[model samples]
Target chain A: MDTAFCPTCQVIQPTTGNVDYFRLFSLQFSFSLAVEQLEENYQSLQRQFHPDRFASRSATERRLSLEHVTRINQAYQTIRDPLLRSEYLLERLGYRVADPGQSEPQDPAFLMEVMEQREALEAVDLSAAGAAQQLGRMREETERCLEQDEAQLARLFASCLPAEAGREAVCAPELRQQIVRVNHRLRYHRRFLEALDQAEENISEQGV
Target chain B: MAYNERVLDHYENPRNVGSLDKNDPQVGTGMVGAPACGDVMKLQIRVDDQGVISEAKFKTFGCGSAIASSSLVTEWLKGKSLDEALLIKNQQVAEELALPPVKIHCSVLAEDAIKTAVADYRQKQKSMG
Candidate 1:
């Protein structure tokens, strides 16, 4: 049987066995991950398992170092981003939700809202005296929306993984719907920020 | 690292970068972004009543890879049926643009924008009906 060796303990752990990555790392599935905590974990892992650190080891130890490094990188990438972590959880549950580039259905009213926001951004004239002020208001509104969405995501994560309950309530359909809404709002906020950046660039270029 | 030169060329001179009137019933707008990189892309396609993409345009605020990805998709989506356009994948975009492994997500974002924009349009049509 294929096994993964832990770089820290030098223990050969079976990959096919029951070793939950999230559980091992003591991370909850939520948008509230502290970046500093993640960074600390990554640094610790790098110190222990990075290939350069294992250069003087035997051939098997070197192979294990590479494998651990790959897993550490993959875990870091997933845990660092809220959206990716949510998507990873969904995928782990056997949901075949396509990435944003896939042809999944989206809500129409949400799209309409996106269009309206785009129009509002385009209409703001940076040449005007209050254009920057207006754009700032828009940016504030977008940031508020993002904060609200993140709060909702925290609630969703709690509901899906209630500490009182066991793993039985993990994959509810409502949680899936909530995830989709978070994804949509996240997309909108990103667009608004981009528009804001473009407006600022234009203002600077014109010496406004 | 210097990105693939071809990818850089497309990014710097992104073809079909602009916008269509979203208020137009025939136009569908797909807005997508990566929060991690703070990159945002807006893609719009004008579809005829027959559901064929008559025109495509985009406005992307991102790194060179993202701009190139959306620009390439707009050119690829135009004149194709929505169904055919949905079939476009990140791998194809990455392969055509020769994106490095690290930048492959840029193509993925572009591919998503196309599907999303088309889906947004179809939803509008359904509500109207």
Candidate 2:
């Protein structure tokens, strides 16, 4: 069996080892991913390759079943997470992300932007009555940024991969750079929301 | 599985759970979050021009392990040089806190917070130049 091909069935098989999540499962990178549909697909795959289902099978068969199940789970997880999915896409296109220990020096412009946002967040007093409303506006702005990120991801998916044909091509360096910026912004936006949530919780507790 | 006693202690009673003034030239803030588990940690350090971390504070809205990790790092960071603080590894934190494999990432996040806080300070210095 070619590793690129879906290992579960005898359809058009791509080879394995070098296969990515996008290739392993035919999915368009979009916000339109239906949770119910995903669950259904996962359940069907579970029934097919779950190790318990193959408990009486031969050793090789059981091993294969276990491997397939792991791949399915990995695929599901990667697709379910927008950040992970973006990172995986970058990896598939041959970008080397810095290891957790290694610091990838970021662009100075991006750092300045981060510093400015952090400063803005800190300067606002969430303890004040009007601060929560201001933070709520920030949250809305962040949500809009998230939507833009999704749109950019959709564009990347549409441009990088060929429709019908499964050939993989390297994404543009410029595009990859944009993706990294968006990833960083998304990280900050998430933190901002968490901080807002904590403030709101405190406000409710104080009954003010 | 039950959390380590030390981790539980920190989680239940996190140290330095507050924010510092980001506008203050002496204060550096690092906010990081992992969307995977919906964990957010904000670490702030007051650094003098000498690059010494005089005070460290953190506020984390995460699991018990994450709280412990941040709390522990805040304690370790005070009085340390920015360089020394960045050297704090997730493994050591996890070991001291006795974090299980599943909670290792929380420790990693704390280590990241330290590095990020230092980096933020460095950026401030660079801009001041």
Candidate 3:
């Protein structure tokens, strides 16, 4: 309903800027998304707003089609990624994650654990036997942590969003804090994955 | 983003890139992370008998900006009293490096590391006395 289409005039319309990404894709507001369906919707929207389709149309209509396509692409990109989706939903619900340097005091114990794990990773000798397998196992462990973070986020979002349609979404402060915490862990896991990729590259380079 | 010359200098030739023994009574270690950028920094300082920071060391797992921030601070920490070290601000580090708004957080992380390490040292001192 919030797309570039008039009900009766059959002409492209403009967005009101209030339309969230979920509404752009005509989906419900939730962390649990059907990614395959989202991809299908994305393809259909891209086709519908293809610039070539507006070549013979009015200049205004052509511009509107381009704008629609750009917005659609952005919405798809944001909603498709689990971490980005969580952040978007949290922002929409009035929860701003702590800014750098102003963040709540983290648990020193947790920080020490992460530091130790990083140290362990750095110590892995790729030249040693079974180092590749060791790296693979570590990657798996990090991925499992990421999945658990996502699952926790899904449950938190479910509880935070309003149950009834047309009613305002009520964001509980406690739940908001929990979501922020999980989001931090998700970021850490994602970064760890990048580090693992770097290690994998090192192993390959050595093999060559 | 292209880093400024000062940032690049610190990042490329990062000073005191190592770790001090955390168990040492005179050594204070600070480990901090910025989840937004997925950066982790560890900064440590060893106090001499005169209660001045005689040495500083750091190991950072982050971008050039983050590394530069910690590196620059480690250079500053040496020879400063704990009170003087505490006075060092993130804004000063940001200004010194000419960091962009996004990477200003890197300087902030460095500032946090300093404060944390100072606090840790104080805590250890209090417990021992």
Query: Which candidate's TM-score is highest?
Result: 3
Tens-digit lDDT track for model 2 on A1-208? Answer: 2452256863322125644554445554433465676777777777766779768867866777777788889988977877676667666667644333334334445444544555576677766778778777877886887677777776765566455535655567777777665655555556656766776677677765
- Predicted model with the maximum DockQ: 3
lDDT of 3 by residue, B1-129 (tens): 788999999988999999899999999989888877677899999998898999999999889999999999999999999999999999999999999988988998999999999999999999999
Stretches off by above 4 angstroms in model 1 are: A1-21, A34-40, A96-105, A126-132, A164-169, A198-208, B1-129
| Docking quality (DockQ) of candidate 3 | 0.56
B-chain TM-scores per prediction = 0.96, 0.96, 0.98
Per-residue CA lDDT of model 2 for B1-129, tens digit only, reads 798899889888888878788777788777765444545678899997687888889877667898899999999999999889888999999999999877887888888788778888888878988
Worst 10 residues of 1 chain A by lDDT: A12-21
Which lDDT values do the candidates have, in the order given? 0.74, 0.71, 0.87
| Candidate 3 residue-wise lDDT at A26 | 65
- Per lDDT, what order, best first? 3, 1, 2
Chain A TM-score values, per prediction: 0.73, 0.68, 0.89
Error of 2 at A98 (Å): 12
How accurately is candidate 2 docked according to DockQ?
Answer: 0.10
Fraction of true contacts retained by every candidate, in order, equals 0.06, 0.03, 0.47
Angstrom error of the Cα, residue A13, model 2: value is: 13
Indicate whether candidate 1 or candidate 3 has the larger TM-score: 3
DockQ for each of the predicted structures, in order? 0.12, 0.10, 0.56
